[model samples]
Target: MKESIFHRLYDTYHQDVFQFLIYLVKNRSVAEDLSHEVYVRVLKSYDRFEGKSSEKTWLFAIAKNVAIDYFRKSSVRSSRTFDAFDWETNQLVSPTKSPDALVELNDDMQELLLALEKCTGDQKMVIVMRYFQELSIAETAEILNWTEGKVKTTQHRAIKHLRELLTNDTVKEAKSHESK
Candidate 1:
């Protein structure tokens, strides 16, 4: 019975948990290992799940706790490094007609990723889950075990920070292009 429940839960939420873990840890291998650990823990604790929350929300809560534990233990090590791209240089050298013409907007993506890396773990989690993963604000709040108001405030701050980062990067890129 426990095994069946575990399988069902895993089948239902494995991808969501894995993706959340990846965004949290920023290391693919570590995220995979942590994701497995989360499932194992959940299976062991299945009886404790009193169904106060939706299964998805409960699972996300577990994932968030697991990530916190991992970070606490590995506080000394650098979590991950984001490489920012030189957009102006890339635009000028490449045959692409204009920076705006590039699909996926790699430069903006890189800047956003870098800014995300600089955020507090809580801020980063909220931003990634809400914006990047497209989870509803209520869902993100439940998953993070936070109040809806707190989630909204954190998300607002994260977006403000991201906008600042992007604006700064764009200005720098323009100035560099003008100098060249």
Candidate 2:
């Protein structure tokens, strides 16, 4: 009975939970460990789930908290690294060819991800939840235990910051290519 319930939850949300952790922790093994910890916590608190939020939101809330705890405990610097990024340019491209186009899209995504690294922690959280994870403002606020206004404000600032970073990076890349 317990096993089945857990399996169901895992089947439904494990990938999302893992991706959230990976975004927060910037480490795969750490994210995996943290993912396991999230399920453990879910198992412990399964009966207490009040359905106030969707189960997905509830899981994300737990994941956000678990990530907070991990950060508090971790001594390492929070310098963001996505050496193990898992992304496909499916959404950014058509069902077309042209290897050059694919490479350009990948470069653009790389630049964007790198820009995300430069955002403040709040900005990063807001961007990841609101954009990367595609959570609604209400859901993002709930998971972060913030007001919707705060989420919106942070997301706005994050986008502005990302735009600045990407613009600068693109100019730099262009100048470097021109020099070559």
Candidate 3:
């Protein structure tokens, strides 16, 4: 409730919460709006926070719930594409590559993001949390309020689905090239 504690929470967890919301909603603007809402709710409920979970994990759980609420209220999904560049690295996946090679790598990463879009919502969440966000399985399970087994199963299935989607895309591209 205190302004200083609220500011501290925003400073510490805003980026992580925003990233999770962006992955969930697929829109930066919506994520930004939702990030504000997450903090607002956190401020309102701060006194009730029992501190059973780490603050970061607690913030993510709130973010996930806020995203779900947005989906429910709007009954529409944002079609914004994922930005595939790693935020922390501030460079493409392979920085040492030549310009053309870097472009190719970017294309591949974008294609992978598109493939991820094809996954079911739960699978997508599991993949983003486990791989993209680099959260541990236990942490992801906590965020999703799922049992660890459920998180593991969803992660396994998501990976399998991603492989299939990427392989199919590669085949389609190859076929197109062959025809060309």
TM-score of candidate 3 to 2 decimals: 0.80
**Residue pairs in steric clash, candidate 1?**
none
State the lDDT at 7 in candidate 3. Answer: 91
Which wins on lDDT, candidate 2 or candidate 3? 2
lDDT of 3 at 126: 82
Itemize residue pairs with steric clashes in candidate 3: none
- Residues 105-156 of candidate 1 have per-residue lDDT tens digits of 4766656766676666667878878876788888888887779998999889
lDDT of 3 at 147: 96
Best-performing candidate as measured by lDDT: 2
The number of clashing residue pairs in model 1 is 0
The deviation in Å at residue 50 for candidate 1 is: 0.5
Worst 10 residues of 3 by lDDT: 88-97
